[model samples]
Target chain A: MTPIDEDPPPPSPAESLRMIAEQREAAERQLSPDPLVYHGPWGVAWLVGFGVMFLRHGPGGTVLVAMPAWLPLAVLFTLLIGAAIVSGVLAGRTSRHVRGRSSVQGAMYGFSWFVSFAGMGLTLQRFDDGLSPPNVGLLWATVAVGLTGALHMAGGAVWQDRLLFGLGVWLTLVNVVGTALGPGWHSLVISLAGGAVMLLLGLVLRRRPAGRPNE
Target chain B: MSELDPVIHAQARLRVVAALSALPEGDQLAFPRLQEILGMTAGNLSVHLRKLEDAGYVEVTKTFSGRTPTTLVCLSRRGRLAFEEYTAAVRALLPPPST
Candidate 1:
């Protein structure tokens, strides 16, 4: 066999500069939090939880109308709790090898949800005696959906992700329309529309190349 | 020539430091992930990382994830400052922007 040189010649100054520039761009990309961390599996889990809740309680809730109202509530509570646990486990496993603002952002994102939900719960409780159960549920749904949409927008702002921000805007519109339609239709709207959007986003994230910018 | 930070001046070391600096404060990247991101061989990456570690510019932590051992890397405070200074020096070498 003919002898071949094992090593290539050193890069010219122009090549070296180009290489450095490329590396710098890659490094800059890393500054942003990984979109998949929040948008992929965790997002899907939340969507699933919300979808189940809407189907049980919203207008589409007719399927479960025969069952005790408390039963659906209980099931929703369990499903959300279960989803939270699963999301936590997955986050722990996947985040083991990665680090950055993602942990902080994730924590903040979660805190926003907690605060929004808690506030909605307390507000609903304060007016509990005045409103019918379904009416109260409708109000709760509107506020909760709106709050989540706002939070998602805020998160998008922080991460500079247009897709996330767009989702937020869409959800906010859904909340408005659902509110006008009242409890039954509102739940159905959120379940079908919100769930579909979230599912699509999750799948898109899953298919994205790892570490690529959200843009 | 501008006063470049020799510690971060090397191509490999500069890339490593740049990547670490890109992370949020106190966050880190696992060794394998960093290696993959930089597209360097494990041995080559180790050599570059050792130089930075020796200079106290990088911090390396060995931890276990279940049964597997993992190596994590992060830029130290000094490293961040050094990289900043290096970038500033490079910018200084460039001519002023045109009007």
Candidate 2:
């Protein structure tokens, strides 16, 4: 058993400061949470959701799967909703132990997500009546993914995480290319290029131990 | 010369205070989680924590998370002020930087 009664000599002033700095960094790491937890759910959601879409409407609008028309939309909505709920719960769980400016920032960020997505949903529904099926799919794909990328970049800026900001930019560029490819191919591109990137990054990050260089 | 807190002057308690102080105001950590962060054995941690609790520098709460009991620890407002003072005192001990 380690001796509790015995006391070590006090560290020098500089050494004492160093210890404090180290412990503070360690505590910050614990408080902030793992990035992998945030990324993994979104990755799976996009991969499965878009993968199904790609199968239902193959590249260049060629019908690959013979499933009922409603099945694709149903599956996609279910997965996206599930992922959103999980991400919200994870964020809440991690922040429940702490409070201050960061908590307020997180809450505002979450609200922004709701507001932006709600607006997108309303606008998409309004336009759904006017557009053809393929065009409708293209509209939803570009706008939703584009907004998601912009919001993600905003979040990254708020947190000052360069990697996350880069990922957001990558998502935007991926969608741009997917948009150029048109409807059916867009899903395939997003599933592989955007969603798969998140999953791969999550895997890589989880394997490495968390640390910050001394500052 | 007596600016340093005798209670916080001890190395183990100093570390405990420092770690707890890092938490945002009103934030807490599970006992096991704190022990893991500090790399201290359970018994040793309990001993130091008792000292801190006795000094009124930390609050230890016994609560149930589902069926299991959890001990949550947080630095009190008094403890935070004390840490700030302790830090100032430590800095005061060092000689001024040469031009």
Best by TM-score: 2
Segments of candidate 2 deviating more than 4 angstroms: A1-26, A211-215, B1-10, B17-99
Q: Lowest summed lDDT over 10 consecutive residues: which window, candidate 1 chain A?
A: A1-10
Fraction of reference contacts reproduced per prediction? 0.27, 0.39
lDDT of 1 at A126: 85
Residue clash pairs of candidate 1: A59-A184
Clashing pairs in 2: none
- Provide the lDDT at A188 for model 2: 92
Off by over 4 Å in 1: A1-68, A90-102, A211-215, B1-26, B30-44, B52-72, B75-99
TM-score of each: 0.62, 0.70
Pick out the ten consecutive residues of candidate 1 chain B with the lowest summed lDDT.
B1-10
Q: How many Å off is the CA of B13 in candidate 2?
A: 3.4
Task: Report the C-alpha displacement of residue A169, candidate 1, in angstroms.
Answer: 1.9
Q: Tens digits of per-residue lDDT for model 1 on B34-56?
A: 88679899998898888789999
Predicted structure 2, TM vs. truth: 0.70
What TM-score against the true chain A does chain A of each candidate get?
0.69, 0.87
